[model samples]
Target: MTSLWHRRRQPDDVPTPVAVAVSDFCRRAKAAATPTEVREALALLADEDDFRVRSLTDTEPERSPLGPFAVVDILRGTAPELASQRQGCGYYEVVRELARVREEKAPPAPAPTGLTFAAPPAAPSPSSETPPEGSTARAGKSARQAAETLQSRIAPRRREPLAETEPYEAEESVSFKRALPKPRGRFTQVAAPKASYQTLLHVEGKGILESALAQNEHRFALLKSLSEQYNGAKGELGLPDLEGALQRHELMDRLTSRERQGLLAAYTEQRGAAGRVAWSLGLSPSELQRLVSMLQLQAEVEGVRERFQREALGTRHLTQRLDLLGRDKYLADLGIKKRFTEMLRKEMEDLARGELPDAVDLPGLCLAIARKHGAPQELVLRALERLGLSEGLRKQLLAHSNHSSP
Candidate 1:
């Protein structure tokens, strides 16, 4: 996937001094081979104007120019061999520290000016003594006369009360039909709460304990080691030899339900090496590795499932809100991808039907779709290719891909 930083850049756009410096820092960070080198690159970035660094770090994730994921990737470096050795978490720690520094160094904002109004002139109190009968008294008399005239003009006119009339008597009695009684047994049914992962694990563990008791001694010991591993034991415990144990016919039988599930649970919980797990489960290292891969694949599928569910709910909510406002057409072209291939398939169909303009920028469109839908560009490209497209469009996409390749 292209980093968000690269995705945000346009071919014609010129890099600002700050952008150029930050880009250099990111390049250096990616080239770092050791923790010390990573720290040095971070220091260089931090040495920039505090406000500039703070602005970049303070940007919200969704619209951020340099996001946490991009920062972590830089910290992890470009080398696949060194990926396992890198500590991407440290980059976030540094960002947090920078944030603290920025907060401490920042000046307080100026207070807002409050609205003020001139007080109305105080009304003169009535005086017992009459004012000296010259200009002041004449002016006061004129003002009073003008005020009375204005009040009389704006005041509402009073209406005279109408004379009382005799009430009429109904010739026949009026009747209202009685309302029907509501139907009974209209109670709503509440759904059962879903079981939590920990609760499910506890139930599974109890079941495993019961079934393991009937298994052979060797198999039971294997289960015990697996349980310990799942619970996060670090060093190896004294147990059956992994190599010879696998050769035994009874042990060689396809993994029981508990065994397969326990392996997955252990793999997820264990923080140590796969070797520890292999030793615990009485399986060869290679077999355990393969199982781990399968578990990872399963986890990815489960994650995708959860993401789709969330997207579906969000899309539905947005559609309902838009419909209520009589603007559902705003969402006519907007949709959530229900499956991994759905987004690319939709785009391909749109292209085939000439729904998209002929001059549409293929690369920009793909990047936008990937970013909006939270899919990797590589996956988007792969799906597009698999689904097929016109020769010209395909060539244009391929050329863009080559030009953008790092």
Candidate 2:
């Protein structure tokens, strides 16, 4: 692996002129001394706490050491060239010896691990290096013990284990749940190429999503990911359940523009109350506004409604409907695409206008959804009362309409 030493610096460290001068002088005057010693001695004079007041009248003003250290500080600390430098040992061999000896008592390896020492650090022979004097070696330890201690500390990677782990309460109780059966089909019905015809349709209230598009894109993506988490087999309900997983589906979308407007209209005009509308009609809001904007143009209201329903319905009812139809029924209807909310609304309005027979209206189906969802007919009464149509209208609607409006 390449060392970090070669990596380019994020920012170049610029050296001060003072550092350059001190370093240059130290190098020339004390050619044999380590950078640390020269640095310290120079610093002593350069610092505010200087002990020496040396004048560089001779060939080497830095020969004494104090003058160079202050300059060295600015050099090493700031210089881009010295950014990767490690600490270098100088004349302070005493502290070095103590540090090294402290580590020697750590542990010994069974094998030499190809370790080789340059020489006995205690008995310094030659070379320019003058290792610091450590504490006196004990006279009692044999050469074997000395070798073992020395061998223990130098090897890298291998760490000395301090203690072994033992079992606490040996007998622990455990429980296990049986695996769920695999889904009868492949991982997802979505894999069926014929399952959906996902095409975008233009509608009226497109501006409803203008500001929220980017944010809702992220939320929708998360919701899509939520749709992917599967475990075991199909449950008793037979629907793919992200809700059961209970992963936080915190990304509730704000009401779409058309939903807000329609809900507001429904509240203020139809129900004679105003606050928040259905709040769930994001798709409806989009369709409503887009229809108003494009209503005069070539855009068909159903197209926009289809778009809204596709996004708004979000496959809950579609999936269940598809599942009910099974492979055979699905193939016949070209895979059972759902109708848009606007279309359904138009149908309901036609029924109310006496244009369609009761058999063709949602009275039957609404009742079914009503009973299944435990809906309140209170909303129909609420709508009629707000419209101030006949008090008879209120009572009839309350008797007939289901609670499942949203």
RMSD of each: 29.0, 36.1
Q: Per-residue lDDT of 308-359 in model 1, one digit per residue for the tens?
A: 3454334533223222222222122122223423543564556433523332
After the best TM-score superposition of candidate 2, give how far the Cα of residue 272 lies from its true spot, in angstroms. 28
- Report the number of the highest-TM-score candidate: 1
Could you tally the backbone clashes for each prediction?
0, 19
Q: For candidate 2, lDDT tens digit of each residue in 84-154?
A: 12122232233233333443554554764576544354454476365444423442244456777666667
lDDT of 1: 0.41
Q: Please, what is the TM-score per model?
A: 0.23, 0.15
lDDT of each: 0.41, 0.33
Error of 1 at 360 (Å): 3.2
Q: Best-fitting candidate, measured by lDDT?
A: 1
